[model samples]
Target: MDIPLPTIAVVGLGTMGTGIAEVLARAGREVIGIDISDAAARRAARALEASTARAVGRGRISAAERRAVLARFRTFSDLRAAADAGLVIEVVPESYETKLGVLRALDGIVAPSAVLATGTNALSVTRLAAESARPERVLGLHFFHPAPVMRLVEVVSSVLTSDRAVAAVTALARELGKEPVAVGDRPGFVADGLLFGYLNQAAAMYECGYASREDIDAAMRLGCGLPMGPLALLDLIGVDTARTVLDAMHAASHDRLHAPSPVLRQLVDAGLTGRKAGRGFYTYEAPGSAVPVPDALTPSPAAGAVPGRQVASVGVVGSGTMASGIAEVFAVAGYGVVLTARSPEKAAAARERIAASLARSVDRGRISAGARDATLARIVPAGSADALAEVDLAVEAVAEDLEVKRRLFATLDKVCRPGAVLATTTSSLPVVACARATSRPADVVGMHFFNPAPAMKLVEVVRTVLTCDEAHATVREVAATVRKHPVDCGDRAGFIVNALLFPYLNNAVKMVGEHYATPDDIDAAMKLGGGYPMGPFELLDVVGLDVSLAIERALHREFRDPGLAPAPLLEHLVAAGCLGRKTGRGFREYGRR
Candidate 1:
């Protein structure tokens, strides 16, 4: 049975509180919105009105519905008005004294069964609950900032929180049209505990000048498919808030990973709190907007080979997944493509797969059937590299063996026209070695695409020392032609994305290795707390243990750093043939469904 929607009161009409109130009122709940003063309350009320009005403008809400929502909200100057409310969500400042005061006041006025919830993102829900007379009734309703827009809300329950309280609040969250994941009360709960640590470390890398801010941000946004770069997100979340949460998490976890970043504190001290102060990691046009202008001090783009532009015909060798994906990407970009396979049967199968994928795109309304047919028409399948003679660009997405790649490039050089750009989609092999395979080393570059190439947007255009300036520019142009974000980086073992991303993933594995948390807990913490689409363990399974281990091994070999060594656990999984979804087993058992 559905619990009746409670007469909800959201206390403290601050940024988070107002947003929460807006969500409740918009959801047809009878809401009481309160603040310390009338003026502050009015401003929050106005903000809510504007928010709903915009929803109406967007046709998300009818004008009549918006008016009804306004009528449902009641503003108050006194705290006692919330006494009869079945639930009071406290979204006050993140201070123990302040929260304790709110709870103690609510204890005296609220009915015996009324639930008291706090919107603390990282604070200990248990400690906060203990401040109330009825500890079991107190729990956390951790909502992301701009609560109405972000879909996730972590429903946190302390050890002392009552089962009924958790269940009721979880139901309430669903009523408000949000996805609620119940989590244990802990420092940082599920999301921020893992997320802030990663953000703090990324800041550390930026501070040390390991890479430029743009490159660092691009590495995640473009390289890893994150919604935003860490630095930019740090700014949006506010450096001050980040510092406070980092300090709280570090103090509680006692783990060095949760340490507060020094740069965060320094920026806070400089009054560059974040969007609130109009500055932080990156300058924002306003407190809550993302229109970013390049900071004059922003680092220059990393040095790399130039890409050539005159390519009219492209050759994609190999009919495996990557090669088929490459052919599709180029074909859709309107380039004449020669797709080769080891045998005619394999080439025919690859063409069928590509056509099926394109048909699916048409079904989803992303492309017209005619356009799909035209794109497929651009690809001419062949049985050997000999047909690549007239191609201006030859990209080998073949198997990863070094000798196999060397042999492919050597054959391409013999058959392809002079001045043809040679590229490799190898994620781990050194670009310099691939370049050495070609007589025109200056034309060979790395055009690394993530798996399921048609869907992923990043293309790491890696340049070797010998690669010409035109080669790098040409790669960037090709990336743009294929509608991908091109990030230029020098020849490094794992390049930018894997170099930074794998280490963090490995650290999470290390955390599990040390028995800090179960695999489910770790993954849940990241997805719920950090807002990542998938958890580290889930992503590990998708990427395959063998592939990840190979990249880790390459990084370790090149850097000779013990820290970069592949985890023994990962190697054991690979040895067991539990290589993620492909093998239906890995860190977690798959195929059970």
Candidate 2:
């Protein structure tokens, strides 16, 4: 039975509240927006008018419809305006006292049959409901930021919440052209449960000075295809609000990763609460403005003053897809590339793979026929590492096994001439381990490239304690030459991308293993709510669960933090040989190719 909820009131005319009111009014429902501050109520009114007017100008609504939308929406500076509302949604600050007080005061005002909802991404809905006068009528209606634009709305119901109230709110969400996902009353339901932990870790990564703010932001944006970097995202989501969410998550589950970073508290205390205040992790153009201006944290492109070694020729080792892709990237950038492997036959095949890849680019109009032929001509296939003697850069793209990479580095050290930069593309292993295998540790650095190197724009330039300044600069310069965004980091497990990425994947697996949510629902929540390019499970399958598990294990071993432990289900799947797309079955089944 889907109960109808037509007359709704949104208390607290903040950004979220105003957005919710707009959505309700646009859906042809009566909306009453209330706030304690008259100025806040006025701002919400103006914002609604501007938003609806823009909609009409875009031909989405007629001028008559815009007027009706405005007529159905009204604002007041008192809670009494919500007395006739069938549903009252509280989008106030994230405080137990503040939320509870609002619920208690509204309990006596609204009709007994009226439903009440709390708009909280974090915080216990059950606790809030239990303290309200009509516990059965209370539920959580968590809308993502910019509620009108975002399609996801988590319809959270506590144990005490009535089925009628849940039905009423759920139906209203669908009627408003939003996807409603019913969830149990928990601190971060599903999307935020996985999202905030990753955000917290990113904040911790930046706080410790492991990577520059710009590099961290660039790495995630280009590396993981995220909409924004963690610090910039934190600034966009007020730092104080994130701290509050983290505090609630930490108190519920004592996972250290959920513990708010010190930088968050420090920023909030300084009154630099993100874009709303003109500063947080970055300085915005103005209060509530998205435009970003230069600040002290912004990195200068010329900071790497060390001049890089001149490179005219490059050597790419191994016969895998990554090797072929790297060879193609350098060849297209006008560098002479020697493609070599342990056997001449394998090296020839790798070069042919690059030829086919370039041909496709020509077929698709990405490159001209002459350009493809010329790019293929630049690649020289060889069976021996001796061919790399004249190359200025020898990048080892061998197997991920540590010993294999160490042995290959040692081989490159013997074959390549002195002053030649030796680089390894091991995603999880420490570059220093491979560096120690070679006599010229100072000449070795990490040139970690993403899969399909020719397409992905990110390259994590990892530097070890022994790597020379020139070697580091050389990799950065080459990465730029190949049109990849290079972000520098210390020689550590997972570098910048995998270090922050795998943990989130592991937690997603845990959520499913614990029966909290299904893969489809979790996937939809992230794509619709968080604006991620792909859901965690979808990416895990594409990345191969086996490889993801290996990276997760490496991270856990390095951190020794209990929270970083690999999810048992991941190990079981790998043990059962249900590796992702490679095996045709993983978190979900895809038919055999």
Indicate which candidate wins on lDDT.
2
The candidate that wins on TM-score is 2
Question: How many residue pairs clash in each candidate at the backbone level?
Answer: 15, 0
Q: Write the per-residue lDDT of candidate 1 for residues 1-593, one digit (tens) a residue.
A: 33345699999998888888988998888999878888879988899889988899999989999999999999997889997788889998888788889989999998878899998876788888887899998999888877887777888888899888888888888888887877777666656766777788778767865666777788788667677788888887888888888899878767665777678878988998777777787777776576876677665645763436687889999989988998999999999999988987888788888999999999999999899999999989888888899998889999988889998889988898888889999888888897898789998999998878988888888988899988778888888888988876778787778877786677677667766566787776566446677889999998888888888888889878565678778888889888988888889887753
Per-residue error for 91 in candidate 1, Å, reads 1.7
Query: What lDDT tens digits, residue by residue, belong to model 2 across residues 101-180?
Result: 99999998999999999998898999999998889999999999889899999999899999999888888888889998
Relative to the true structure, how large is the alpha-carbon lDDT of every model?
0.83, 0.92
* Clashing pairs in model 2, backbone N/Cα/C closer than 3 A: none
- TM-score between candidate 1 and the true structure: 0.80
Give residue 558's error in model 1 in angstroms: 6.7
| TM values, all candidates | 0.80, 0.98
What local lDDT score does residue 372 receive in model 2, on the 0 to 100 scale?
Answer: 92
